[model samples]
Target: MAKKKKKQKPKQGHPARLQQGVVSMDRVKVGRGLDALTGQFVQWYAEYRDDPELALMVLAAVRETLGVYAEVVGLNKVTDFDPPKLLAVLNSMIEFEETENPEAASNELGTMIYMAWVDYVEFLRDTNQWEREFESLDWFQKTLEAQDPFAGEDEVEADDELDAILDSEEASIAALAEITAMPISTMGRAVLSWVLAGGSSLWTSLPIDQFVETAAKAVENDLPAGLEETRKGLAVALVLQALEAVNAVTLNPQAAPERGVRSQDILEPEDADSFDVNFYFIQACLDMLLEQPGENDQAALEAWGLAALWIVEAADGNPQHAAAPRDEQWSSEVWKTAQVRMHELRVLGLLESGEAYSLPNIVRLAVTDVDDDIFEEDDELDDETLDAIFGPDDVDEPKRLKRETPYTGEVLQLKLTLKDSKPPIWRRVLVPMDLNLGDLHDIIQASFDWYDGHLHSFYENGFGGTTYGPAIAEMDYQKNEAETLVSSVLKKEKDRLDYVYDFGDNWEVRIDVEKILDADGGQLPRCTGGRRMAPMEDSGGIGGWEAKLEILNDPDDPEYEEVAEWCEDFGLDDGEEIDPAYFSKEEINANLDLEF
Candidate 1:
């Protein structure tokens, strides 16, 4: 959760300058100054298509308004401000804010944003875009005497893909109802609010990521009348929806010949190897979230990543992974619903369709089970093919095994130096030969006494191996750090590696394998020696750290006390001066013993 900061006052002389353009008037006088500003805002909104920077300023201004009157504002935090909604709110605020009652501007903007959100939801419903949600409603209302006014509206035809999904979801709900003995009405109501929020379509689509950014804001702000429960339900419903999206292909039984009457030949790996389709699908979702093409959409990626993981766990038959304070049986019932929706995705055809999809890896790895009759090698292989497959009889004979070898404990002595340092803050450590890149991450953090508070990554110098880091970075690189071994990349002494900590600060560390040792029966992965304390957490890299050092050295500096207090928080001092050039080999080894 992001902590809300105190709103700083607007720049000096801002209101004074605005007063010249904003004519003195109340909400009653719309034709005067307010209308003029609305026109200007609308013009800027239109111009945003060409000038993104100008659009960003408008978003910042809206955020400023939200931040200033956060307590009174009813809209959720505007994470990714849609240009049109911002335009609408700007126009509405201009109408409501009187010259004398400037505070009214923030209130009006908040209300308008909330209204825009509601209208957007209504629009989705009106268009029958809420397919998942509509199905939920249809299930419970079947017995009602009051005829649905939207029945004709529902008949509005959907494409084959969408129709397949609607049919699958309906089937899933029915199956779960039977299996769990849970009433359709109860399940329907549980997810009713979710349907209104655009459901699964909203999530996998680009907009859901933007919407999630405002979730904290939604939690803080007051929802419209009778929507409190809807807001609350979103807190849980999103998880279910995200999982369903991640598992859309696997849960579809019709994709496989054995599971359904359709007898579709689902793709599978040709060899004995079986790829974890669920894992790759989740990775693809994470990749999409991390690449967030729109504005500040990092929040969306994180929310979706969490949901994907939960869904994958459920699909693997471990619903306990999402252990919230809910009925375990009900949650299992939901899992069954996802399972039965498998036919919704024709994964084999989709993979072969050559259509651009979010998960290319999933497409690449997807294969179909070979026909047993066609694959019978005895009948299919020609004399030449058999000869190629088995080689000459004498040459094909197996070689005898050599005697057992003794364990040769190998250690890599690495020299890590902070990049761009004057006096040169560095460390030397010896790690085991078989340690993976993921474990090495811990060693580097401990070597520098870093708390591992932020994102980090490793790049092998010269070699084109994938970059390894936090989940988002790994997803972006389409690689897993845990799967990469240290010895695989760094083979001998003088081999170089680059480690970067805290993407924001970009604290780069240059790592060189100083020596490859035979271990000499010594305990492995202990820091052998040298240099300074790590950079302060959240310090803006080398430049910021240097600036802080300057402030600490000068008692007369106005910011000295603040810097000192921050250092104190890190347990650097009681009254003693902070030491940048301090290293503890013993402490490093002790930590390594526990960590390794």
Candidate 2:
């Protein structure tokens, strides 16, 4: 017995799309990029805010720079652009001064906070550095700055509550703001929320300053509500855990390390909250829609749609993917999902016309009756492609090749042998005159075993044969081209010979040609596309041939004797030798001048 091989199952995990690495504080690539500012504005956050602003800028810059890097560089590094949920998706709004803009949608919540802090700190230090830098950028400079790399995290974690060691109350409050900026919470509880939700991280022990400002924003922003909100965070974490369940999303340490957090883990099967844990989970799906719209499948489409509806409904329309105004269609996952499902329904033949194409059309196509393997393709070509390859003038050719010939017309023969049949009985045919390269193709079809559906092209000789040329396809040939069958090939004396394809179904198949005419026969005429119609009685067909044959008498009827003898005598043979006695001496004399 043959041993059965096991099919390899797809492994689980997210392919890291984002890239991150540790850098020493001293040797890191560059620092404080936006030190100079163009005039025109306020320095309230920096001059008046001072210490709190410094702490804020540290994180603000980290977040902002990471975000800018994401846009210019793209999200390909972290999650292979897969989807996930962020419980903080709601909280992320607080970081942005304005969330409703399209061009603004590209702004990183972290970057916005960082730049805002930078603006504030610079002013406080009596330094207009970053603003000046930002001001001097030409459009080209802005584009280049947008691609700058992520800032280093000092290669060290506080390892302890960073907020507790702060000095004044204002500074403490600033730490609280910064705390929320990072996920400082712990293995789970958003540290900012840990402080807000009553679970202690380092924030609880911090001076009164920490909670003052951001806590006010936290309460004012009112991200979700109660444990329902924290529960939402837990829910998202569960999604991440489920990455191990379905086994498609895993951390890509090799490609991207800790920052490699991916889609599968973002929305793991067993996880709770779903999006509140991390918005990128869903954003990843949306990212896919953004990057590649035509890749959506049934499973992926459904998952994305449901997740979009959930996030939108759960957020009550206040989506993190949304910026300030909340009306933008491209920025909302719910809006994006709805667009895709509509496409799926439309293509599935579920929806009617009138609407424009959506991102889902880009993600997945609709299917009616699919076999188990959705990817298998059939061997039929679409009409558009057929028209394209052959072109209107070719498939619908209006011209024919004209050839001059001697009085006696040319003839070609074809023979076929089957692989399994014993003795493989077959049929033969001979055709006449003025026929060009394309004409021989049809004559061969009429004389031998051919299929109804396959396309065919014919050659006069083998590969390079001129007169007979290659048959267009195997099953069917052009009638116009088939009209002028060649008796011989046009070979050049330069005799620079090259290899060519020999025709027919396979190696053993062969053909022969003969040219002979009585000296008294009139000169051959040039073939026009014009040709006499095929006799209705000549073959079995839809209306006449098959019906006519069914009602015709048998060959033994004696009346049919003439027809049978004509068929046998006129047919071409497979290179068979003919007795001289069967032909006049004139034929043998004419052949004496011929050369291969």
Candidate 3:
């Protein structure tokens, strides 16, 4: 994830919404005596009443430490922000200094104590004490001289207490685990607590040795013992332990060692080849689900139901060649078990009851029992539903020319295909002459049900050519999307352009204008045709989607059940067979209404 640099000056329009929130460290609540550290600092600051320079220096040290901690956790923006917590930390550190040196409390003295505590703790967290560079007090003389104002009191007592805390094996391990598991929301508070505890000499050791020991005990695999004697070995062990905890990857205890244990012990899983596919597919589905408001419960339930049905249907199809590691193919038996599992989930309150899908309107939708002319008034729709249907205040109606006939435009019928897709997945969209490239992007997204969560760009000469999209303040662009008309780039039939969205996923759609309408006026921009469901969002582009298809086709693959379960979770693959070539012009038009 790229962290965008903050702009120096405010932009003209509304501020851009942050893709993610900055984790507030103030939310973390540290354990034990750490809680009282703030109160102590407040009291100490009051004691040093005349020492303004001392106060500034002390405050700066606290702020600097918090900033360093934030950067360590990848929260760069949060470093210099959150004044309330900084103030609290400043109070605590002063209070801590007062208790340590009541007779000779100076700004220079307090800053040294605070800096020493912070650097030492961070050092332990980042590296081991056995490493030569782990001497945290290496900066003791420099920091004091840099901020020289008065002859400072000795910090030997404070250093001694810090050393005592670092020497305690159990205390440090517990603190590290808590730090590592700190939730994003509570990180700030938790970090403050650690600093407070360390200042009080409550925490005395680092968790590296303890974590390594724990991993050795829990994992059945023969962990390399040779690395225990070397700094490099311990570093590798530290990383491996973290990986093993998450199960992102695993290690083999019995693999024959050629060069060393590091070479032979780390083992790749059977699905390692498609790790990106599985990771991206699951993450995309989750991201898609999260983007919707919680009030959309009914729609969410329908999606879940549909996904369940898709899985059941795929399992029953018994297609050849599923994902690897398992060979039990999809069969009637698998379908039966899936049904049982679904029922059990409902009974256990894990899945919603059948009532979720039992509404009359939903039933009608399931059976496609609505009127043939979708635009015609529906006799079955209730007064409230009818009112909702014709709700004028709900949408911003697009302006159209007042013509005796429909507003006519030169229509370009374009085919958009997923690059490198097997069996070729694509969408056909009709673009109006007046529609700008920006709106065209939206129409394409609507055709494929993409959530539009990532950045997109249109290229004049396909993939690597001149691009135009949203403009960033820091960069110059060849073209601006909102002002660039679709017709301006491709006026004639058979002309083409390339559209890519979600740069990370690199989903490239080839837009080829197959036919141009001479006099036709109908709904200007609409889906004319499409093949297959657009690959799940973030399914690692075409390759990941294909891998997922392979898993769905084969029931016997070890990952088949897992893949099927995943589809059900997102309600993507319901038991009902979804035709890969299915296209509904009415449905497409309905979506266009929402978009336009």
Candidate 4:
């Protein structure tokens, strides 16, 4: 008879298995504060539990609010509740909602969450469990009152009419025609006057009648006077709105078109806070606007010039007083000055023109023109002069030739190794040579189970070489990663690239082209092999990772419990100690299939 296998004993502190998909709470651990809080919550919940709908609503609100707080702050006790912490959580929710769904005026889920917190706080006070007397609910009440739908119903209705007019293309065209008919000098002077009176702020804050009156005086035109009740008034209003919109876009490229621009976004040259930079940016925008012939472009330029002049006027006081009187000679001098500024702006890569007429939408301004002719050898200049102009001889290296493509069915087997990782945490992936760098970035993220919550970049040669990444305002990049194909950078078996994610932690990966092979007709861009688990994001880089591994390896370590808890929080643990050498090729490939 075969010997019977002995039943293995369960390990100490092992979590109980789920029964019928229900998690067993018998083995779950709860902190003293959490236990007390829950006990009170249960009693409070019982009061409304008779009405199932109200009870469910309360439960969901409480769960979502507490859940987000726990996710953001790792809140494990009632003592974690504080005004600043709550404020941070609230801001995160608002920013996320705004970014994900810009059309929504307010986050309803966030409102519910706040309401739940208020109720919980009230419960704590009634039960006499509240110890932080300084934390007030008055601010929360005021915020809720401000968000009340009925508070400003009439004002909202009035604004709706103006908003509709602004949204209408026909109205915009009429307004543009009116603006274009006015002399450029008149427009410039109006802008100057508007700037002296306090730019967009004063205009946006005034009543409609007052704003129309002010606009008329600035333009020295009688068209907008007493026309606040007519179509002409709407034209004036549209011009003001367009000016404000252009100003908003100029200061912050990321500012949403529909939202009200903040005062903080506007940088005054007289403020001494990065004044020179702000002033130059404004000048660059004006120069760019002048390059295009679109009526909207001209109008935007006038608005921008007004802003620029305002900065100058505010700094030095009434630029007209400096005395080049309005004349044909004065106009020529002004034109020459603008030309010089335009050339400077272009050389700095701070200004560029698009194919169509639109508002001045500037993004990704480079400090220095990467393709400047100074890098090219000059036959007229001697070696010393050439060296002075071009820095050094070694810097004038030949540019890499891009691969000529009518891409064949080619696959690149890439080996991505985490930099400075001992035992070399790595992954082997097969990707199509024609795939864009952005998609490759996604594959890399998925392979390592990275959250992709931070900024990332690909360097063609190395960190200081040609950069490929998302286009961010004021950031210089050689090409957009989403538009650059992998073959453009890596065309051979041995070609390599470097990638870095999370600038703070600086996690680096070196990607090498290990093999060039013909396509096998299998699913492309799939992971073939990898070793070890990826380090948790924000784990303080390699040094912190090493320390974490040391603690994880030894259960008896003083900080092992805390470290294990953190791992659980990040979903790195599944009721078992995390293995340092863990890797699953099938799992990675499955994820890659889903991603690709």
Candidate 5:
């Protein structure tokens, strides 16, 4: 269970003594502002107690206001808030809304942002932290009343033009030509010729070596005249590299080559073969390309390469060959959800227009640059300067394995024992030999009746070995849990691995391969044995859990009632009677059957 940090009240004359233009040399206090903001949320929620959804919306607005305030002021501590700071935060928010999604800016979103600041000021005053003597809200009202709401009409008009271009092929081409400083006719002719030469499939279907040679030959013989030789070489190189990346994903559909990207991390390779997974993989790659279009030449080629591939895979009149059925044993809800989302994309005209040989939507996206004003930093800052200003954003490369053998008709019966438990809590289950660590994590959650609310990882050798888990920002790991298979780590009987869940609570489970069995044509992942119920979430660690059990077992204890109430909140049992020895194999198997 994760522990919340205790909030500390502000000392007298802290920020009150600091004069204007003087940076406070105090050590940066973390979580103090967030605690105060949370208190403000409680106060706001009290008014809308009957409407929980409205209360949630208010909470979201408060969070957004806090984020924007942090970006504008470079600090989030509420002690830093003053009249001048409030005005700047509000003005920045309004200008940002007006620039991006102006329609939303004119609606309740703008009003919500304004009211959030008002609530914060009121909270400050109520807490006796409002150091300024002036009438802040009244002054803010008068200031806003004097401003022009339609100040950036010309900028808005330009934004509207970009939006229009995003929906039209000819407009997109013209915009691309303008941005690249290329002749419109030459750009148009090149795109037409590429589409004529089988569009995306020509690049995707051929072997890597053949595609590289083919692209190089096309640049020399078939590219439009008047294009610079250097530009042509760059284009071919970028497209070939992009094609190679997509092909790598097609080959290893389960691997998360790009961490922190949810679309790329969700699918398991066992869910389907390369052919069945190709369409979604290509879409994920295209999303990455658009989200982070590198330097100019690289960006243009990426847009062209990925956009063409997407058109071939998703557009009408160009269907991939039918794929064979994947292993029925590997069917899962995650794959089903991916399929549904894919259908939604097509229905919403995101991936396809239902027109034969449609032009790519991403071409316009590449040309129309939408600046993120809130998070924008100075472009003039060099890499070293930026690194000095902010901390270095470097991470170790994730570990990967080369699987040479395919899954045979084999299953592993494993015993998972919870570490440091008094009477012991454990589960024994059968899983396929080829199950990835990601799926194994899910099974562990099911076996233990955990809510799967926290991050988890599997260790190959031990704590010293490779770490496999989901991609989290700034955290280093050896491999992605979804991509590393069970067989790769535990090959034979008696092989062992350690699984840790809820990093805060640090519940470690020891997994030992008990037996290697042939397929008996029965559903795997069903729990065959176990002992005792798992500990409640957020119950601290093993020590905390033991303390709670002690309290619950004794009615006369001072903390008994409180501990009992907490247990009841988890739907465990009535305060009077608790069963730590409970084990329900049938219920566990039922959930596993549904999940896997």
Candidate 6:
């Protein structure tokens, strides 16, 4: 949880400035002024927040006010008078005297910014263009990347294709219909062409990459919200949504598939000869399952169950996989619901009506787990449930292989995003999933200086629960090897994985815990599951410490732009004034490529 670390109150006689003229004053007088300024700013912003145009108007007015205030303070350049920047200057005045407590300084900063925004919107309302401001609401979206911290809104990127699409609405609308109606194989091309023509960039000012990520997230989030008919929009949306769904399931422990359908398609290259073909089917299955949740669970599961069997049977059922039948006695409400789905194919008569429906029986029938419980109780299983799965008659004796080859190839990519902080607050570490959490830990400890934090995030296919099986796993290793793990038991990585962010301010800190594990018996060194620092190749010195520190310290290096902006716009300066943080030439020397 984010603790709003408190501010230290000022002592008697401490003075706070208003960044206008000589702000030197007595403590009580300064506090009263700061409080009034903050209250007014907040009030202005609060009144017109719902109306974007009005909000912008008010914002402009506030900026003018600040600019005038700066002029009063003997500052000629008003361009540098951003709300955050203004507050920082005020804080600095108090700090120079050493009379303001950290907390008091912070509150002053917050209150001033609050006023600036309020004033800005009121200015907009006075200007009279409400529609544009209303549309600006789109700019506030999480993915929109309005670079200039002082810029009132995000700028849209112009893609030529989008221009054409927006220019010809009727034609574009017709094209969209075909895009959706067309088969998936040919859909990408249509989507490409349509998006090129759709002027989607005009929709918001976010950068293309973030726009895509944001669009993808939007589409994925809305997949279940209800599909709209935008040709290219839906196409890109599904693609990103699929990736997200895959990632989500890999991270979080969601309720079992609504239809109780389990996908055993391992994406590893060694076992994946026709992965593309099976992958296509998996995508289809997910779409059918996730988007059409209105259909009965059993009905959907049966259809997906058939699809799973179809893949297996296409190769004569030799995949060496087994799952409790949908009709099996698995003791999960989620699974039970999936068991009796009346297949969509059956309802639509598509199964028997078309040439595509004639796949062989081997591809149709899957082993429905009957009365036996093959999954272990790793997550929710009590002692009694554990005994049941491992009972003498429940599972057949295991066959030990004479040779167990360790995986040296990359099977899964571990990208840790410390959930608590902001984005790209991550590490992309590649390793054989088989490495233990302890080993991963040593590697992490060597790479970063998160000295006292513990715990890490772990998940596989979004399935987290006890009753370890193929979908769940853990971080610590089993004293000995005879165990099975499930993706469901891993920590919540659903939709987006969540990892332990126990580390303190430096962000390099991993919480005070040890290790992480994956679904396959593969292990990661017992390091906290968060974003990795620069890899060894990029780790110029001290096992990447110097490299991370360089990137960490000089954030404006094309690398730190986003984070740096977020810090300032949000007043995350290292207890300094915002002016030096955003506008001072020396502070942004890195941005100017200036030496010294």
Question: Comparing 1 and 6 by lDDT, which wins?
Answer: 1
For candidate 5, write residues 1-596 as lDDT tens digits. Answer: 21111111111111222121322211112133454466555765565344434654655565555544443343435445444454555555566666667687657555665665555455555666655453544454444343423323323544565567656656655544332222222232333344235434564466555654565555455443443454454444443333334443222223312222222222222222222122233333334433432344422333333333333332212332222233232223422433333333332233433433232443223222322211134454333332222222221121234234433478989999999998988999998877788878878987887766555678878888988886643235779887888889878999999998866577899999999888676666679998887787657778888998888768899998777766654544342355678788887876666566
Cα deviation at 52, candidate 2, in Å, is 59
Q: Write one digit per residue (lDDT tens) for candidate 1, span 1-596.
A: 11111111111112222212222211112222223344444454455345444543544443434322321222222222222223323333444343447676546544444443333233334545443334323322231112211211122322232234335645434322321221211222223233334342434443444544443243323222222343333433332233344442222222211121111111222221112323233333233322212433333322322333333322212222222443332234434432222111112121111221121222212111111121233564432322222222112111222214433678898999999987788999888787788788888876776755445678865335557754441124445677888998789988888888765567888889899888765556778887776666555678888899899989999999987876654445347676676667877776666565
Best TM-score among the predictions, by candidate number: 1
Cα lDDT listed for each candidate: 0.44, 0.29, 0.44, 0.51, 0.51, 0.31
- Candidate 4 accuracy as TM-score: 0.36
| lDDT, candidate 6, 155-237, per-residue tens | 12212333354466564454334223223323322322223334244234554455554544443432322233333354454
- For candidate 2, the lDDT comes to 0.29
Model 6 lDDT on a 0 to 1 scale: 0.31
By the lDDT metric, which is better: model 3 or model 6?
3
Candidate 3 RMSD to the real structure: 27.7
Off by over 4 Å in 5: 1-408, 573-576
Q: Kindly report which residue stretches of model 6 are placed more than 4 angstroms away from their true locations once superposed.
A: 1-331, 342-344, 350-542, 561-596
What TM-score fits each model? 0.38, 0.19, 0.36, 0.36, 0.36, 0.18
Candidate 3 Cα errors over 4 Å, as ranges? 1-405, 473-476, 573-579
Candidate 2 stretches greater than 4 Å from native: 1-426, 430-435, 442-510, 513-596
* Model 1 residue 27 CA deviation in Å: 38
By summed lDDT, the worst window of 10 consecutive residues in model 2 runs over 3-12
User: Model 2, residue 76: what's the lDDT?
Assistant: 22
